[model samples]
Target: MEIRRTPVLLSWICLLLAVFLIPGHCFYLPGVAPADFQKKDPLQVKVNKLTSTKTQLPYSYYSLPFCRPDTIVDSAENLGEVLRGDRIENSPYVFEMREPKMCQIVCKLTPNEKDAKDLKEKIEDEYHVNMILDNLPLVVPIKRLDQDSPTFYQHGYQIGVKSPHSEGKDEKYYIHNHLSFLVRYHKDEQMDVARIVGFEVKPFSVKHEADGKWNGDKTRLSTCDPHARQTVMSNDNPLEVEANKDIIFTYDVDFVESDVKWASRWDTYLLMADDQIHWFSIVNSLMIVLFLSGMVAMIMLRTLYRDISKYNQLETQEEAQEETGWKLVHGDVFRPPTNSDLLCVYVGTGVQFFGMLLVTMMFAVLGFLSPSNRGGLMTAMLLLWVFMGLFAGYSSARLYKMFKGAEWKQIALKTAFLFPAVVFVIFFVLNALIWGEKSSGAVPFTTMFALVFLWFGISVPLVFVGSYLGFKKPAVEDPVKTNKIPRQIPEQAWYMNPIFSMLIGGILPFGAVFIELFFILTSIWLNQFYYIFGFLFLVFIILIVTCAEITIVLCYFQLCSEDYLWWWRSYLTSGSSALYLFLYATFYFFTKLEITKLVSGALYFGYMLIAAYSFFVLTGTIGFYACFWFTRLIYSSVKID
Candidate 1:
């Protein structure tokens, strides 16, 4: 039976291995629709935003052409250009944006002038209450005499807006805003790219304007919230349009071209990080690592060694029976934990998450997932997580049966669905709220169905296959025999209590990664770029070492206290970092974010729960196995009759 089970499991593993390794027909990254590198010279601009610059939060922009494409609706790949963050709606302003014109149309007297009031109302309703440039993307224009032109990083843009009264009541007319590009150069005036230092912004809204044409008129407006307080005041001119003529708004996006080689674009971004904070965090984590390493060493070399030596020297059975400490607990050390089936299910899910994290990080570090690749990282993670279900099922079923459990089917079912269902439910609820807000970030119904199909079709069947094979195999061999009657656990001191120890044990692991956590949080919420996967991989290794070493040290202390309930303690001790992470996130929000909307706040914390839960499972899995191996090593070495 054991031999047969091995072949079945191997077959499944081989099949999956082939699937992942194979490229063309196996899997393709979905929903990545980044603009092509050099589609055309000066890509005809996309769209204008509907939201005002005065609004606090960022708003969506739409594609005027895609909404009303006339044989020029060029889109790449599977996604329609309109569906991919391109607010496609009918708008009168589309033409003004597409074909902006600067004209001083004098309202020539018509045979019988059309109702001036109706024309004014029509213009106000059609044109979106005047227009303002809130955000824009700029391309790098440089002439490098080296190899073929290197890819230039796009500059971030923010055109500021403001008014006269900080509170209310103000008198002003049509105001003017000017934009200037600030350029920086090396001491020698050499550069590969001329990075924009900043931009000069002036914002105002039209308080009033003439209805017809430029026939000597005046208007009202307000001024800035200034950057580089050098404003070019303009004489108020009667810039107007008639009802029957074509009205156009014209502006130029002139580039401040430079002739210097730029520093490596990647290095420029990396320098933005404060080095001191990273060093401080690294030193702090190292100190904890050294402390835990010393403690584990002392226990293994002195305490455990001395106990094992003393037990071996005892000649008579009575003398051996008198031995204590960890040697005495060997009989019940491998005893099945209370609710072993549930514990096994939990462990299995933890294994799955850990496995997915491991594979995803490796791929990221290997350069398979770069910033240019867009959705590659997330797509890879999702696929790997689904494929890891087989391992989850095998681990859960194998452990459950080892605990002398008979319900293999029950354990397998929970292992497959429990954690995933919880995450999906929370995600669906949050998505519904996003839909209510009519945000583009909302997952379409088709995408949701695709996710469900992936889960039911691939993950579930793989888990079932694994469960069958695991049940066919014999239970995992226990190093020490269990007694029919359970051993009575001794009362532990305050310091030795599971909760206290678990709390203390968690501090080190959390400290190891808190510095990196800050940068990650900033990137997500502040919308900054974060591409430090190489550094993150090193931190990941440090965290793994910290978790295992601390758990082992704590498990040793618990056994010495004559407490046999190491099962939950081991899991929670490392998993407790999730608690610290949650607390830190709360602190980050209060201190860092200015999020005012209740719905946004709810969405923030709701997604955070999912992240924290996954972290708990991943770290918990590492600690459990570390303790499991430690317990098995000590007990199996003792001379048990």
Candidate 2:
């Protein structure tokens, strides 16, 4: 029995894991707590004054004083007490709960801190509630200087908060908490602006956190969430600073657990998982395995066998069928793709991108970048994309030379400029739109100039080198020559046209994640949390499979129709996915997203263009290779005079 080793084993394992194990064990941001810190030497400090404090904190906050004693004191013994007693019922406020529960709370401060503390005492005296006073870590100030203007500063630091649970084991912890700070300024300007700048998750986690629980041994703490670090500013004098400096940044934490517990059940597994991103990634990885299996099987078993047998037969008989498919088209196999210069540049860039995707997926699968890694994945992808310009130039020049395009200097120049120019133009326009909205994600002007500099300095040299190598290599020789007379065109149905079919092929995949697209768009435009890599990963798989299969089917039709112009068809068909992506964004604007016209329209189309162009090159490559092989195989089988 012939054994298919690589894909069969890999794909089967992936599929089983996804179907049976993923749903339960693949939480997004799992085991995200700090290491358990035992008091090495308990500070001999007395609570000079025992005061209970209650303040309405933001609903999104999911932290508490876990490290050191803080300004705010609670009446309850533990966090559960505050949730059960002080929470309002059926109120419009964010923290307003039904009788004694709050679903979504973005914190609303009650009376003054003293009044709130008095209320806490009254509630405790009348009805007993568990109140616990926990100490928190000290906040460190950080500053980010504008490279262009050093004087102007953007202050921010990495916020590291640890949940009160062990690193690996799934356990529940308290959430209703607030950070109280008393800042004494040594010296300050008479008038200056002060505000909380930015906060981000740090990469200190040793293990993944399932849902919100820390998983692993109790002796160790998960670094998934260290602390919330923020850059604060103020121009208030020392007296005012001290008076109001007892600033309480109240917040609540999310406790990830299930009402019912099962050791190995799906729900329990999911509960123990990290975050929603893991769910999407698992699905995406499974689909990719499926896709690779199908494609490899076709290549190794069906296509390879047929091609080898035909080659042997042709040599022995010295005669072949007239209707040989791919074999008959060998001469044109190395023909320059349309828009040779542009195509060369794109393809070269695509090679680099392909490498990045492989590396990223491997890293992710290896657990260095589980779904719980937050922006680590995006940061990696961004760096990879920026650095892959060399591949774009190289692949483009090499392919162009293979196709007998000899304008080396021009091809190199085009390759160097194609991606950087287009991206810069698109990004600039998007930044302009973002300028109006005051969105932080906008690429700054200095960064844009730096991009230009890099393109000229880095990409240009690489392209020149790549073109030199490509030109130095000999042109690929074809096994067969094109006949003087063109084959008669066959009548085709409406659906057979490349344009129409490409449009049709992209619809289903787009539909599958149109709802998901809104979440992504909102993150980019409205600055919402999009840490759902699992969902994004799933959508990516759907997109790739849909593009590949749809393009392949379309290319097959064009070939059967005797349309030798199958080159562009393969590309455009797969590229049509970009069009659908754009269309979905447009639809999202009207139905799902809420944004002004300037930010909405510009960013929408700007990103669309990039997506479309990238898809065009990727899909085109797949189609061209597929059609080329098919043509060569069929043509080679034919008898020649």
Candidate 3:
């Protein structure tokens, strides 16, 4: 039975690794399948939220004085989309498959003082107008000198530009009133059908003049003459947005056949120019892992083996008394440390975070959370975190029981509420700030209620069930009995002080992951696509190994010095990496970002603080477990009577 179980476990482990580590393109998203269209089918264009890197706040698409549909109905949003501040809605711009339309008007708008002020503010902030057609996001193609084709695509076009007036004095706001769209489609020769593959737009500011008295006819403009094939040109008079000015919104749609297929349409959007840099980051991380692995192997094979062998050969207590180092702490090594309850709660929360991240990454690497499915990643993370409450409760309850604590319910409640409550408070504060800005990034009351429901209704009950099950089982027995009277710890060198050693122990783990951390920050703050889940999963594994190994090494050194307070030290030692992560984020903020708004700055730091706290929990938990296993294996190998 043991032999069969060993093979079965190994097979399962291998299968799990394969599922997580495989290339993302191998598997497709389940519900978001590809769409095919027949000839002349109406393709509706939808507008998404307006985003700006400068502000880091997304606003509703129709918040500005733009053309709107009659009903102005919002598109159905998933949890992820809502959280991401995506307010997708139907636009007045309509299209037909394989058909060309020229100089079609999309409603004219007369701006009020408030509208003008809002448009000027958005233009000054450099917000982009995001649009979607057939689920493909519209992009502004940027030409590159190195490439013959326009491979680099900006996610969205700038709403308008702030240019100096003709007097070359004060700057004036110019809105791009005319949009020339090029819709690329893949045609099927056999079935006489086509699929929309690309949506590109070239924006212009054309001041139109009517040939005759305008009676609300859309196609009666001299500047955009349809008969002679005249179109909006960049050199045309720019449309300066001012209060009470009538702004005519016009668009042209041109369809073109493309070789790119619907299945691989997102390939172009996901192609980044920093592929080589990502590879270099992976190599650097691997080198750090290899170095740490070598050090750990030496400690395990040479030093640990010799010490265990000599200790086991002792004939009497006198001989054992002469022995120094880790052997001296056998009686007190497993002793519960001060504030063990808090430690248990932290470890349990870390377990929950670890499970959530691991599962989310697995799904991401398997292509279930693709870039095309906006907000899918955030939604998956949130749902997974809620479900992982079970692990949190079980781990905390088990640890508390082992520490000889009888109040299982109290420990379970702490495990479920402590970390989450802190995070929730911080999130709520940040949401309030966003609400003050009147930004769509703020969480709605309905969503907040739903979150509370998930916590209390589902997660809290699941945690209680797990804790009950954990407490019902027999408590885990320590390998060696802990003495009733604690042993006195010896004075150590200044370098071995808890704070100093923890700071030192965290350096290597931070070094291993800082490279990848750059790209993650860029993706979040700079609004770039981050689909390199395969590299991310590898880095995550490396980060885990580095954290564990470093903590084990530091714990061994501390134990050899007759210090038995390994419980919290092991956690803080690896967890200190989060301190460095937060510091690096601060540095990134000052040097890389150009954010000027106070609220935007606050938002960045607030979100980063949450991220750093999560990192601390995850790394600290890994270290505690590694050191626990190390101490147990070492002490159990010798006679301890």
Best by lDDT: 3
Tens-digit per-residue lDDT, 580-623, candidate 3: 99999999999999899999999999999999999999999999
lDDT of each: 0.58, 0.44, 0.86
Tens digits of per-residue lDDT for model 2 on 1-641? 11123434543444345434542133322223211212131211111111111111111111211222323343222222121122211111121111122111213222355543433333322211111111111122223364452221111111222234534433221112232222111111233311111111111111111234422222111211233122111111111111111222222222122232111122211232244545464455456446645865575478656765775567656465454544444444435557666656666765656666656654443333443333455556655655666566667766777666768788778777776678777777766665554433444466556556656776578668766876777765555675555555556788776668778755644554555666657555432334333345455566555555555555544654556666666656655666777766677666754434444556666776786666556555554455556555555554444
Which candidate wins on TM-score?
A: 3
User: Residue 211: error of model 1 in Å?
Assistant: 14
* CA deviation > 4 Å runs, candidate 1: 1-40, 44-59, 63-160, 168-251, 255-270, 315-318
Task: Write the residue-wise lDDT of candidate 1 on 352-383 in tens digits.
Answer: 88888888775554445544343456677788
- Evaluated at residue 244, the lDDT of candidate 2 is 16
What are the RMSD figures for all models against the true structure? 11.4, 18.4, 4.7
TM-scores for all candidates: the values are 0.72, 0.53, 0.94
Backbone clashes, each candidate: 14, 85, 0
Instruction: For residue 20, give model 1's deviation from the true position in Å.
Output: 29
Cα shift from native, residue 113, model 2 (Å): 26
lDDT of 1 at 331: 76
lDDT of 3: 0.86
